[model samples]
Target chain A: MSDAYAVRDNILTHHFSDGSGCIFFDPMDNSMVAATKPVEELLNKEKSESDEQHCHIINTLLIHKMITKL
Target chain B: MCRRIYGDRFTHSIQPSEFIDFRIGIKYPNFTRRFLKPQVQFSSEGLVPFTPLPADYAFAMLEWGMNWTVAMYEFQRVIIHSAVLAKDDYAILLPAPPGSGKSTATAYLENNGWRLLSDEMALITKNTTQVTPFVRPICLKNASIDLCKQMFSHGTFSETAYKTHKGDVAHMSPQRHSIEEQSTPANIVGIVFPQYSKDILLDIYPMDKTSAMVKFSENSFNFNFLGQQSFETNVHLIENTRQFELHYSDLSEVNAFLNEEFCK
Candidate 1:
């Protein structure tokens, strides 16, 4: 339902979540911001979303293809 | 006068503790009286005031503050020593001196159900690394006495301390319900050094860890005598906690803002 975000620097970083949503705090001015899932919490959610998940998928497929060649 | 303001009152009472005497009575606003009051010999000698105030009233006030200081150490497993408050598991440690409006902030926060850790001392056992809960009467001085009376309206405040340097301070005993249910061991989530300012909005800020430690040491009750033990405890606490400096004036706004910001 509600996620807890720590107040750090100028940006809010991902901590832990309930898979429902996440929360973040602005350290510069101390404000609360929330990131919700299935809406504004996915890759389509923000421009700064990490690409690590896609890279992992591609790496797994590459490994599978190499095994087939062997 | 008793060497310092703190010396005279506790001289006869503090003899048996065997806790180290670091001579740190006034430095730390929170690491206050180490133990409670011993039975006073009113008809004997010293601080014998003939101010028409009842002996029971004066004796009880002194006993309450002193006993409160000890209740923390003896029962450190259940309370948080920090000055801050939160809505859920939220807590903040505010360490400041007398005129900083801490009482005003505390009254406001408790009204919001943040729970009172202690208005006097922040008890921490050297080994357990936890804060102890001390739910006693909240002592308010001078103008704050009147202000709090107006604010709480129905609070049971003791007769105000008369002819004292800090002014006619009064202790407001918490409701029976609060005293019974307001005890918990909170994590030291954040540290704040509050400097009250009027006309300012709510400000949630941070402080560097090392400097915060030094400030905390200065705020210790028996740190000097405890020597290495107190030093070690300070180091561990600073490492495990977030530190900050809060400068604000309005209690209602700060209270609402912290509940929203830290608890949610």
Candidate 2:
């Protein structure tokens, strides 16, 4: 039920040069998940009503240790 | 044939080394059929015995078993199924599936001027762009066997083993310099996906870095196993290196193109 969440720059979020997709990498435990369109939109600061859904996805990933909670 | 071809290669090593890194003991079962036509099985430390092959093809089995051991057991580096050759500290990754003429191009490139890092795999560090050398004999299969012999006449080659899974196969001896400088690490400059085409002269297609990264990740042996480290390493590689899809028939043309592109 933690609320605060932030993606870091170093190894957390990787922006692709070819615009294919970004990947979120966890350094603590060698885990990774491909960024979905919703995640990308959130990351790019695009307008969307699915903000809670995107955050939920990230939070679920955090629960799985695929990402970290800020 | 393996011993005969790689005899001088072993001498290049300063310290005493075994004929093969993996001590695979080849044994034959005793039976009436075994006496009539013997079969050779490969067994190593802690590994179950591999299926038996005809006694004549024992050398080929040993070579394949050794390669399998490395590809399966080694997890330190992200092993890419590619042929790597280097020149002036810049490495060229030749990644392709089987029968794509990767080995032939590698053999030609190594003999011409480029130093051979490995023909089977490129052991790349997960944290950095550093590639470790697993210098061994370059395997030439099917038609490549004759082509290699014709192209590099002076190069020592093993006796051809016929009709064992991949048709005819032989081992091409690596250059003395490559063996001596086996431990030297090379920075990757370009990743080329080469395809041999009879009609094509030389078709070079540029690849996007992200697409190239996906392809590289797909071709890696332990990319999934290494996880985040593999991701970081791949990202580092794609960001810093050029990627291409080269369809070539002529070695000279390919060599010239590589020289013009990477050597500068």
Candidate 3:
């Protein structure tokens, strides 16, 4: 687990109660990013960075300005 | 045409307390055009918003103009390019693009038993799952027009507008129950992305919330304009509703699936 990154300000995130997936709404650009359960876990800082797939997801989110370094 | 299509919705009498939503008119563009290869124009608040169509297309142009006016001016609610149908006070939002057989399915369902909230757009109040009724005629294109007429022989239909951009269009008057209950709003209980396929009998694909959200947003008419409020409202909607992608050729089977899964 790492607290090195945080969801950007004004970006709304909705996590499904059924654990299916989650959606992030970026108000700045009026864009939405849909993520799988693993990506949601990574964003919540509940998953380890050791997983290569998780690192890629974090990189993608950061590039899209959906997350920022804490 | 208005009398034939709108039925009870049309009247010469006006109540002082009633608020008119739009002041629209269909008239000949100019004096000469009215006689020579005649054409008609659609105007709202004295401003013409569309090119004049051949005189025969006057009624169709009016319908299109009304849709345009509402979509451009109605900002209090999030409007989606969808067909809204209800059963047992629960609304189902069918968001699909043209040629997806959405209007065809809507015609079938509304004539069968489902109440038609809207056939063209879904007006959803912000930050809530409730969909307000905007009951109006269901616009059917080309083949679907004849199909619907055959299926619902007792149904009222507008005169066909031949050789339009959407290819020979006509409007079907919504069931009387829909217009009678026009002021009632229904809570959304399901979202279905429907595609009509001639070969498929019925194929139901359950969509994850994330996927449903993305697809639903694409069909919205004013998603970006509403900004964060739209986002929150759509999120709330997806969270509360069951989502699916249904591909089928049979309307009866589709109706059965909807009734079994969402109507209860």
TM-score of 1: 0.57
Ranking by lDDT: 3, 2, 1
Please provide, for model 2 over B64-113, each residue's C-alpha lDDT reduced to its tens digit, 9 standing for 90 to 100.
Answer: 88777887778878888899999979899998998889999999888889
Model 2 steric clash pairs: none
lDDT of 2 at A54: 67
In terms of TM-score, which candidate is stronger, 1 or 2?
2
Taking the tens digit of each residue's C-alpha lDDT, what string does model 3 give over B29-95?
Answer: 8999999999999999778989899999999999999999998889999998999999868889999
lDDT of 1 by residue, B1-264 (tens): 222222222365555657742221211112222223212222211232222233334533453435444532443232233354534455566677878888777776777677776676666666544565556667677778888889888666676667565666677765544454456755555566777876987676765554566566567665534544555566567666766677887787766656555666
> What DockQ does predicted model 2 obtain?
0.28
Given candidate 1, what's the lDDT at residue A48?
Answer: 29
lDDT of each: 0.53, 0.78, 0.88
Model 1 stretches with alpha carbons more than 4 Å out? A1-70, B1-87, B127-129
| Best candidate according to DockQ | 3
- Which pairs, if any, clash in model 3? none
The C-alpha local distance difference test score for the whole of candidate 3 amounts to 0.88
DockQ list for all candidates: 0.02, 0.28, 0.69
Give the fraction of native contacts in model 2. Answer: 0.38
